[model samples]
Target: MAAVAVNSPPGHADPPPEGRKRPPGRRRIIPWAVLALWIAVLAAAVPLAGQLEDAQRDESVSYLPDSADSTRVVRLQEALPGGEATELLIVFSRDGGLTDADRRAAAERVAAIAGAHDPAGGAPRGVPSEDGGTELYPLTLTGLDEEEQAAAVEDVRALAAEGLPEGLTAQVGGPGALQYDQEEVFGSVDATLMLATVAVVAILLILTYRSPVLWLLPLLSVGVATVCAQAVVYALVQAFDLTVTTMAASVMTVLIFGAGTDYALLLVARYREELRRHPHPLDAMLRALRGCGPALLASSGTVAAGLICLLAADDNSASGLGPVGAVGILCSLLVMTTLLPALLVMCGRRVFWPLIPAHGSEPRAGRGWFGRMGASVSRRPVAILAGGVVLLGALSLGALALPGQLKSEDSFRDTPESVQAMERLTDAFPERNAQPILVMARDAAVPEVVAAAESTAGVADAEPARSGGGWTEIAVHATDPPESEGEEAAIEALRDRLAAVPGADAAVGGPTAQQMDLGETSRNDRMLVIPLVLGVVLLILIALLRGALAPAILLAAVVASWGAALGLAGLVFGPVLGLEGLDPSVPLLTFVFGVALGVDYGIFLMHRMREEALGGLPTRQAALTALRTTGGVIASAGLVLAATFTVLMTLPVVTLTEIGFVVAVGVLLDTFLVRTYIVTAASWLLGRRVWWPGPLSRRPEPAETSPAPAAGDGR
Candidate 1:
């Protein structure tokens, strides 16, 4: 009896060659099915995205500060925008200060307009401004729903236009106008970003691949990702009644394309290298996956970790972004690894058909100058470190001056209805805060509260409430938007007035206060999320490398990258973007996104370095091997990633624009500097210590070979 080994395939030393060539069973079939499921979801999602309410509060800011009437006012402010009420900015310009006759005429005209509603005739509401010169009327739409608010404002605008008194002009601005302005900014930026994104992506891909056919692969994958991701987001919102801003679509565009292209580049770069290595295309693909798969997984895992970290954000914002972004990127990476591979198999030679070169005699590690550069850099570790530091130092100086002010208008920029209304408001009146400040008191203290509030500093005079008892309502007017810090002076002054009111407490409650709270919340959210994301990434790096020191060092690099990114963004926006200040929200967003995601490169490089080390190469030799083999992939992936994020600069909203630039710059720096120079240098200089306390690393043989390169070449 022949002693045949049980595991060997029918007494052969190895499994079938085709087994080695073709992709395994489960990996090939599942992705298309998943993709189909996504297509179905998207078919259900687009119409839904258009239906939800805007994320910003058209409602009043609620404060538990002082008065009982404050509660009543809070109820009114919140209820008003829901069709229980609306407000119009009434302006009157006279040769002199408003006198009794002018005041009466303005009041009467505003009241008449307020009384004139739809055929239902549930009179529009009216309230005078702090100054007699202008008044704001609060009108409830009687029976309109949230979707009808835009039309309601338009109707009111038309009514106001026709009923102006002699020598007096009236304009409507509030939640209604804000809704319109938001839509304008979103539409303008979105269109601009769309055109710019397409142009930039096309040109960059053309430059990178120099093939139109290759260019379309990423576009298809990304398009599918966008439709599916949006559908999921819509379903989530509808099922859970989730609150998302109109900016979701724009954000989805940036994330899907950016992640998709980056992943696509990784695949193409691998495929090209494989084609150069083998006589057969199928053989080349297997070689590509074995060489490139793990590293791609490492890069994407870190990115997923970064995005998932958004769950650490204080409100639903970070959490919402976490799911949307993480799910989107996962979708992108899935397409990259599986769908793309299958598609490549189907397309075969045509994927890069026009420019296929003859296969070489053998596939060799370290493809020439790129390999040499990696080898040389690992030798002069200190110089590399010095250069990296210097580069980061220069770029980071820009971040210190970053403006922290977040524009309130950012959330509403997507809807047509919202934009038209905002435009009407801004054109008609540029300075409206839209959300009104209210002084509320308990039901029992309503009368005294109204009297006291009427006497407050910012209060010009007040209206006697026709409605709630103990809820004698009084309206106060702002000298400017209550949310403006410029208005802080008047608010403080008003606080003093409220300070003197007997048996009543008054605290500022409106958009300005909400803005203040939001700023504080964002800052606090940063303090929390950075650590959480960093920790998760650090643990992941540790698990990937099974090393102690690699995680710590990579995490340190990420922190440095974050600081450097913020420092750079500060320079661009604090001055160049002419922002009032760094959207206080920018730093937190950057830290969780740009910094955390940038960790991916470090993870990818380090994962390969560890693999090479385990394969018995010395620290320097492993570093050289990792760099030579992985550098091109890292650079290619980084280019697509950076390019994708960079497209945000073309968006109209300052937030997206600033974010795009900073994050793009960070990815570029990470690929070129951090992965290539710093990681390699550190690994070389530290020698065995870079992977310290886990296992002692060895220094393997470094061959100085001649410079005749292999087949396919595209940097």
Candidate 2:
């Protein structure tokens, strides 16, 4: 009928106007500019890679004496600056009463190690300070902050290795104490993560694309961006003294590749499509860029916005990831849109190797299950949505038992110097330990409390006025101690000891306790963050979708997915891994990852639904089509990404382990639960009202004729 009309146009219809035109996107100038910027950025970033680590190192300091009053503390403290001491602490215990003989023999050895520059023998020399007990050695380096100090873990380990000479032993802790082991272990890990990530990315890209150039080119562009980003981050760190944590590089890798590759995929797919339609390679590149660029920009904007929300965390550690993550995503976005396009254009169809191009229709048949799944979902919206809600609710219930504690000892592992020292100290001085009972008196009666603190049950000994300021000073010592928890129990006992004293109160202050506080704060933050973020993200959805009901429905689905992820984490890690509970920060972090990332996939799916609606496809057909198209890609991408996170389980550190397991699980659940199962179903179930209250819902005028017709057309 259409062909007959065209041939009979003179009689069948009014003569067409002579001069109509192609779409506005036909202009090639913007794409060329994008290409140039990508190349330029790559050129600029590669040279600055060498200095990134130094720039990234932590620079915080410690607050402790030049050395522990005990010889053991002196040895550990002396490791840093000439006169400065490491913030070293040790613990001690004894079952039999402390005989003078025991104290003297321990004292003699400690005396040699204390303040000894001998660096070579007897009492393993360095700076040291004994905390509240002859049993514990507490030391801190002067003029250093958390980020700036190197833990004198080795000195403590050596002293421990030499033997306690009898019943004496100690445990080393504090910042320098904790970091010493962590830094050593962390160094080995960096190498492994880097190699593994690169190898995996290379192997996957090669296998998927079946082309060396396709694999090599994207990496090259990312490499440039990464190195430059490193340099820039380093410079920024130098200026801001920001202490980059162990995970910074890993984060950067994910952001750069995830965002970068996504853009490349969209562009490449479009390019391939255009090549089939248009004979000229240059024209195809231009067309592909023009068509996909706006979509890519919008997608990137959503991702960047989600990440930036991390800045809401008050903790420097969590807040820092925001800008750090954002930078990498930004760079990835730039390289893909510009340099990647230009490079691909230059390479042209040659980029697709192994199977040389003949004609351009898709190289492989464009068939997918997503459309079918979506259509099915469209058929039964209520059942799917209700099931999803129930699933999320069940999973979230498991999170109730999750605990918040620092588990500092576990985070670092076998490598840190201080941890090794603690092992030795525990062996050498059973009576001495590194833990401290941090006493804080907000009132002016600080002196009396310090004096009376010795009466505390855990007090093997107490020392006052070693460091810091104001209406208060600190008194610390190792526990008189049981054979059990050492300072941990001692600190508790000491807290009870102070209770008898009027106008005085105290809390255990040490790495473990501080971490506990951080965990609690993080949980509270999550509580605040999730609702705030959900509210904000919903508003964004409403603007984009332009409807009252649809946005609310999507938000409901995302919540369900997030809840399920949390419950699933509790099930696996809590029961299977036998973790005391998921790490304190795990729930909040999991929530953030779930809610933010979940919403992104939801938005993408809904956008497709909107597109289908506008095209006049009936609701059910549109959802089925959307599933076949967008759902497949979402699933594929989600699988690969979630798998990458799963690899975190291989790492030795607990913090990373928790992050890895929860996030990987969350992503997997999200793809199936929300992206495919829920959203698809909703689109079908909602139908025209899916566009309700928006201009899209009303029927269009007859003059439109749905443009030139769709794929399976021409009746």
Candidate 3:
């Protein structure tokens, strides 16, 4: 049966006078038209979405800064004969000491690997540590793509393990093995993140609605949004040469679901309210859209703008994430605003059956939890605001204890064979670098470059590995272990010496050099991108809220929350989670996401508050009323967003783990503490000044009266 506007104000009832009635034919056609359009879009989107995995580029050069010397060397090497080689080191060792039998067995295994794979040097030569307990055989595999290289590493590993003497073990490592292991983890990350994020969002939605069926609409819509976003990103990668790494893709998934669901919740809440005041579900949805549409647009715009600021970053992954995240948010906004409304109108009241909203029923009575909290803040805004500030300040101190830059070998939560092998090699060969520093120079200057490299302070040996494309590749070994301070210093000295060689045109690169470049570039990216993001977010807030003071307050709160969340992660990651250091990109990513996403809840509350104030409610009461009305939905949105990000912690990669932890913590803090307590309390204290320079600030407060609580007062 069609819903009738029962208990509606005069002239609002269904079957209005003939002249006032809207054209029923057109009203009926629009929803179906929208639904059909979406159906067609998804049909094309789903197939293209599956191709996103192929477009993802996770190679070292893909993530590196193009301006870095290390990146230059890698690019130059790619033009050489056979392209860049996949370097691997096989280590064979016995704890007490290596017996003659162990040596013979290791040599045989190396010979077998050479015969099967045809290593670059024709055959590997064993370098025994003076300790007489460890032997290292370095192998270089050239002329292989990433997939072929990974397969070759696996084959070499299997071959190296065969027929080993009892009490003797062989481990295949080096940059190639590490790359293979890392890629293997990344290969599974997409599926894991998708499944886990879906599960978390589903549970949160069900809990929020307390209805089995109501949650499915938003969840399905968000999924559709994700597929559409992936298709768009895939197309951009093909056409624009965009870089999409597994990291960027994973973050995009979380962002679409989290922010998309937030938009859905706000719209749904308003729709449910309008249901009591409008006869038809379509009319009610139209009213709801008008009420919440601007806020949704502004909030999503803030997030997208903040993310887009990352384009200023020097880091490729960070820069790539800018567009990827923006696309996800924009796609999410388009779907939630268009498709969700259509679905809700079609399902009507039945979707929320357990607590179906009748045409004129009031929401539950009694001052809700948020109302009570708001009242308390209204009574003592100064004290509450101070307490919140103090809490955040104390938490932020933990940042001082945060660990240094993360090393490549320490980037994983679980110790892989490659990490283990690198560790063993470090301990066994403390005086020799297992990995060589690659130097590229003009072929005519090769002799001078080799002499300069060998003469560098910490140099052990330097040899010309190959020559091609008018360049000669020289492999230089240092006297210190890989990634050690001494080794880093040696690489620096080698670069300095090579630069002094006239007409050499040399560049230094290797695993260690790559790590160094990564750290420096991350720091630079942070400095450049943070300000851009903050400025973008501020402008968006000012545009939405129409108030400088309120936007500034919200921006400050989020920045503080970012600091507190980072500090909290620092405290938790080291002592509680056993992590050594954070990923270089984590800090910048967390800040961008935290500030942009954290402001979403603030917009929901403040927008409502602005509406209430504009409607002539007393400023103090408006603050409380907005909180009373929007508190539950905002909380639910926050929980869903935080939970979706928390799913990243389950992955083995430390970078994702740190990002997930920090963002989840920051969202929760923004929800319960910052938005609920601080912003509200600050608004109450600031009163009209919160809207300074806006007409709302200049408007006089309405006269107060002991009127009965309004319908949405939650009392």
Candidate 4:
């Protein structure tokens, strides 16, 4: 009989005994069949995935809360004459105050634009600033679709640039310009995010596996998952009219690579271990799946569940992210489990290259860094626990410094042309709201609505801009700057007074109104989605761990880490990075990701500990054993996940950058500090009680003979 492998070195797979191989039958055919099935599926999915960009709905109404006044206004406006008009403000300015030449030149440029484009109203006239240094031309370009509107804006900008007199700078600003910039950014997002994410994942995989050939398997599987996810999302959008935002699409990629690679890491590590015991690669893979499959399913399910809770959000953007993100995670889980295993089996033992797990060999025991750390932690459990708490608490204090909701102008890392134009408008029109307040009223109540708006305290002017489909559009200018406290108060007052008009179902909307709605909806979403995510995650943990105490401990540690991460972000975002304020959605996003992903490491640790305890080791010994054996893989997974999120920092959008930084930081903290020290110490201190209410929580029967092997022994 051939000797069975006890513990093999890393990456060296043992060959089967001579004349001892089992008959080759359906097993060999099965792997190639699975691989062929995936190849066919990938081919069919590529075309559908290519169409995903066409399904994106990035308009303001697409993101607004359904119950918000801005949303109502948008719906009503679409029913009006020529649909919603694209409004633009053209500003021509000179530093030393406008000369007669600059004024004449500005008028000529305005007339030139009027001639080239069909204006909704008559020819636009230049309205000079109070200081006489700037002239503004308000143009309403109506009766055009999205593409035509973009073309009109581009043409206007071109004319302004070409016709501007020397020393008089001109820019196109307003709703239309901002919308164009947003579209431009989103249009390129898929390519930029995909490329960066792929690069990051590939680098991490190469480093983690340290094999020229092994890293490609997971990356290829993840690629298949990504395309499949996109195809699914595309179908959802086409069939159900789902809203897909740039933020949601970008985040989907991050989740796929981060969560998918994490599962791959756990599976690969288990497969490597199994290789030492089972001579045939196929047998080893089966054993690996049996061991790690449940953990991967639970972890992915937890993340998907937490993300699905976003459907409760009032904001369309937030709600859309729920299903979109869930699909990505589920697809990744599907591909990684099925396709990855098949590929690994077919590739054979040599896929591991330099560090193959040869059968009948034992790994050196009790000498790894994780084992030493575990021993030290077991000796000073109380001290480690207290220190971890203090460290997390200290980091969390930074949350107090986090800035308020970010403004539109500060949305990007680098200022785009639209932002620059808006700034110029701000400087020239400090007393007047460059962006008009849009009010939709019943057509019958137009006179009353116009009168009330003009009589309002903060009203600079009110005019009936358009009327159709039983709705009258009133353009009102506030006396205060856009998004200022005074402007917000005015908007509220307008809504209040307009609501009182008989037969008028009026709704107030504009740039400022949208901001108000966004802020309110974000706050409401946090209240709703945060609890839902927590409940979902807690339930998943309980199911996976099959006990109460261990799940609770894991939950507590993860929640603390999330808070600490946010606090840390607050410090860096505002004080250090000099950002204006955080995006309102950042807190909720960070919470969901930090808790869901952070808990993953906890699951990896506690699951292994439970396994050790079940195998008859004492509670303290089990905890230490689990940590020593699983620590390296957990650390590697953490780094890979963190690196993927950090890729988001390369984007110009401030929101993505913030999400990336906070999530990446949170994952690292959980892996190194929370999982390595706090969880380990807490488990050691609790002993068997960590699995309370389960059979393992009770004392086991005494061993008949010799003491159990050292915690780090491969056995």
Candidate 5:
């Protein structure tokens, strides 16, 4: 019989003869069909994605825990007369102490602001600071939404700047002004974050593939995923009233680009390998997807599951992130798995260019770097394990130095005018509260609430501000500085005092109260959400590996990585970065991202190891093979993921910068140290027991012989 030619790569198994062939016309049609379908989807998603910025809710009510008193007060404020009041403090300061000219200029500006934007309760009045160096005009601008409030604040600022006396500085500050500044920052976040993320991803992809053409495919696919995820989130916000914060939206972009690119890298790597085995690109893609599909699905699934556990959190911002982040991951997975493959197939093998994986070609045969590392690890698995543990433990010690909750004044990387104004107020008025505490009580009990607030310890003064809608608003000034321990204690004392008012049902809220609530709720959320995330990720790992031991090991490694990452962040943020303290949300956010992504690399390595083991290699041999075959891909993916997050460091928001730095560091740690050395060493040490309780764990070690040829060898 005449020999049948088999166009297989030198090192890999021959392509299955049956079902390898497809009609050429169908192959052409399918890719075009997928491309056309995605184009349509992208078209429909554009408008909705644009609406995502509009749907963002960054108000305190959006992020505060529902159980918090501040949250209740915020809700009640909306029901007050003319809706929630916008308070602005127009601060005018001079270092040499304000002269008559400065005071007159400040008063004139205040009067002009009142004339332009009709103050709600009364005309603006200047309150001189004790040292006479600063003057503040407390104005209430009511009956305006966010846009109008921002415009009003801007007008006030403009008036203050016009005809200002020499050596005098003026700025608008208060909760209203701070909110406006934050809105301004968030308004530009989408464009800025997207640009930075895309630039980073494009650069990383170019380096990883070393092919200009290959990088564009993954980038385009991720862009589509981002748009799709945003559209879905927009619909959820509109239909289900999902709370989408600016932070959440920004984070979703990062997740989609980072995680989606990760999936693309894995898929492309597998496809490139298969290209050397199959004659047709379509056959190669099919075989590649078939080989890597489950691992990809499980990787995204684990991420989604772990994120969804955030739903159990009390903080609305944290809870909202759960669905938003998961949606992004799922969208990325869908596009990468379906659309990316079609595009790669359509482009054909030439897309790989100089390093194209031609059929019948073999990978270089030698013990690669990962192979040598694995060999070294296998020889002294216990020492490597102990060393890894010690290193991680040492890094974790930095957590003890982490600063306390981040204050609002410290939230921005670059000081905004509002924050500077607050600082000026703090410095000039040490005895008076610049930002007053707001107390809401039933109108009938207003007198009682006021008296109690006045008599409360730590309260400098209490006065009725407004009365309507069966509710009365009282402004209480604290004797302590804003967000200080004394102020926090005073707030608690005020709440306790008000709680004792018979039939009053009072609530305390303001910047101070909000900060206190955020700190407490964050602590509570960490307590509740951490276990839930761990459990969810653990369950997914067990299901994917179909055993308890490997999943447990993976979980332990990731948790250790998270602790070390946070500890390192603690050490760096305050001393090196000049941050005042770590944001309360950083720990929880980093834990979720680090653990989920760390486990992602774990899944990649272990799944490959399991595949080798099932192919009848002993645990040590399987570990070495998995490391040699998968190490480069994991490293590339980790670098890409870490680089995408590093883009956040460019943002001015301290929270995002902190999150970006911590997660990036964590990913690099997991990629280089934990996944490469520790996990591989553990696998070698545990041997078949790593897959304990599974049938494969009991399978006898393959008979000893000359080691299997290195990964690229065409044995």
Candidate 6:
């Protein structure tokens, strides 16, 4: 192979011998100063970052809409006589029938729990199943905070299971037990996600860079970004009382690594190219930063803006994710743009090690894979474009198989004790409600509200449970099992009937109602937030690209990619993974990330294409040149980002797993298929029209000339 001079981009020219000297004293001082400043910042940030876990609020109330009826019910319930009670149901069941000894053991265990905890309700009475196969005991432990409630639930479970008969099993269920189980999942989420994400990102980086030292720089910068972002988020929570859930923190962790590393890859690639053009490391790095800096800023801004649109969501978790994610993106941008560049300059060219880019050494030429792909795509642009669109559309048909909102009991990958207990209760008490519907009304109209609730068509029982301040709480049980269609109808009927009571001001809520409210709010949020996210991203692309047609084309490709990702998820989530349904937040969150992140690769490819076009290349040659130059880095970036999200699939929570799966699929599609084939093909076919309304659209192609060697020829 013969080495040839790599083509300089656009107007760039080789530096004169004197101009290729070491950086001046001031220029050298800048990177050192920047490094010192970061060290000081990290010193202060470490302690604050450690406090982030303590600042997180994972309670169900933390995720509910601020003004929803369910949210109000929770607030009022906390004001009752005993603060907020931890309610649990104890179930003792046998496959065939409970013997007299089994019944005695169940009662004795319930009595022990009552004596130990001093439950608010006097003593729990056993409710036997008609088949004599199971018995249930309901109890409430009041005046307990979240920690105390978790402790109480565990204590009750231990007491209830003491010395159970061989054939009989005892399990705890209800709002309190369910909450404790959910808390357990979230308790380890941060550690689990961080470790998995770090491992995944490290492996991908090692593969992408193929240099141990080079991979460490990006990883280190991302780690710095994570700590700084967490510290910032913790401060926000302390000051503004932001709602930070386990989900938000976990997603933010992924974003910092995924998006931050993306910036590093683009900058590094450009730096490698500049190194071949300049003699000094600092000069090469400065040139690299100058070349790709705007694209980096624009791409990061687009992601941040899309995430910021989440502030308009009604669901607390969704809304909280907006700022938390935005903070993470900004922090990542700051670190990559500042700390990473300084580190690379300080480390000098040897960081690339075995494959260092020597000054004036031209790269060898070979038949590159991306170049071949571009050539193939260019040869049949229309056919390729139509085929890609049809293929994505075909994949999107899986959306029809998507199930409804996932039930709380089914939200975990493995059934916890609470869900197991609920399943047993459902089997044993087919006609009885395992959970009560809570109704709150003005104290003055408590009697009338109770009367209306009791007389409702599906009401099995309704009684005033507690009163405090100006409100009274009533417990209503339906005639059907929890979460069943019959039970849902009964709840609606009770609400309707209670609403008709003059001056009652009644609000209906409970475990089932909370799930209902989440689903409805999520549906409404999609309508508002999706459009908002798309608009924000579109505007950013338009501003960055300075073309209506190009931005529209990029947006459309990302949107189609999102649909294809969701459709694929729908197919896998149920038939392959055995999941019952999706979490209400899954679709909207995936769409936000899918579109925002997917567009990044398009930006990389198109920005390069635009550069080539501006440098006097014909449209067809410009498109192919851009693809040949940027394909490797974009593919590497897409893989890194996809793999980081894939780490979430290793988590036990079903919602996180679904989110990871969908986003990973979307990124892979965008990297290999959409950006590589569809976008490039469209550019080749549309020619300069892809940049309509921009100056490039009106400019004539330069006369045919000898093609310069491709930049980073062998990269």
Best by lDDT: 3
Instruction: Pick the winner on TM-score between candidates 1 and 3.
Output: 3
TM-score of each: 0.78, 0.77, 0.96, 0.94, 0.97, 0.96
> What is the per-residue lDDT of model 1 for residues 123-228, given as tens digits with 9 covering 90 to 100?
4343343444444445544445445655766666666656455666555555445544545465465556656666667777777676668777677766666656
Candidates' C-alpha lDDT:
0.59, 0.56, 0.87, 0.84, 0.86, 0.86
What's model 6's lDDT at 222? 99
lDDT assessment of candidate 6: 0.86
Q: List where candidate 3 sits over 4 angstroms from the true fold.
A: 1-19, 23-27, 706-715
- Model 2 residue 21 lDDT score: 44
lDDT of 5 by residue, 1-715 (tens): 0000112321346546575468899989888899999999989999999998899998768879889999888888888877888988899999979999998888888888888888876677788988999998888887898778888888888998899977998988999989888888878888999998999999998888888688999999999999999999999999999999999999999999999999998888877777777788888787777777878888999899889989998888999999999999999999998899899989999898867778877666777777778888978999999999999999999999888888989999888899899999999889988899999999989889989998988999998887788998889999888899899999999988989999999999999899889888899999999999999888888887879999999999999998898889889999999889777788898899999888999998888888777766777887877887788778889999999889888898999999999999999999999999999999988889999888878888887455665753221
Q: State the lDDT of candidate 6 residue by residue for 1-715, as single tens digits.
A: 1111123455366455464455489668978999999999999999999999988888889888777787888988998888877889999999889999999999899989988899876778999999999899988888898778988988988888888878789999998999999989988788989988888898888887788799999999999999999999999999999999999999999999999998888888878877878777777777777778877888889889999999999999999999999999999999998999899999988999878888887665654778889879977999999999999999999999987778888889989999999888888877778789989999999988888887887778888877888888788988888877787888788878888988988899998888888888999999999999989898888887779999999999999999999999889999998889789899899999999999988887778788878777887788888888788788888899999999989899999999999999999999999999999999988888988889899999876564455544433
Model 2, 192-221: lDDT tens digits are 765665666666567546676787876676
Model 5 Cα RMSD, Å? 3.4
* Highest-scoring model, TM-score: 5
Please give the lDDT score at residue 256 for candidate 6. 95
Which residue pairs collide, candidate 5? Answer: none
Q: Write the per-residue lDDT of candidate 3 for residues 375-446, one digit (tens) a residue.
A: 789889999999999999999999888877788888888888998998998888877788899999999999
Instruction: Report each candidate's C-alpha RMSD, comma-separated, in the order given.
Output: 7.3, 8.1, 3.2, 3.7, 3.4, 2.5
With candidate 2 superimposed using the best TM-score fit, by how many Å does residue 99's alpha carbon deviate from the native? 14
- Give the Cα error of residue 272 in candidate 6, in Å: 1.1
Model 5 ranges off by over 4 Å: 1-11, 17-20, 712-715
Comparison by TM-score, 5 against 6, better one: 5
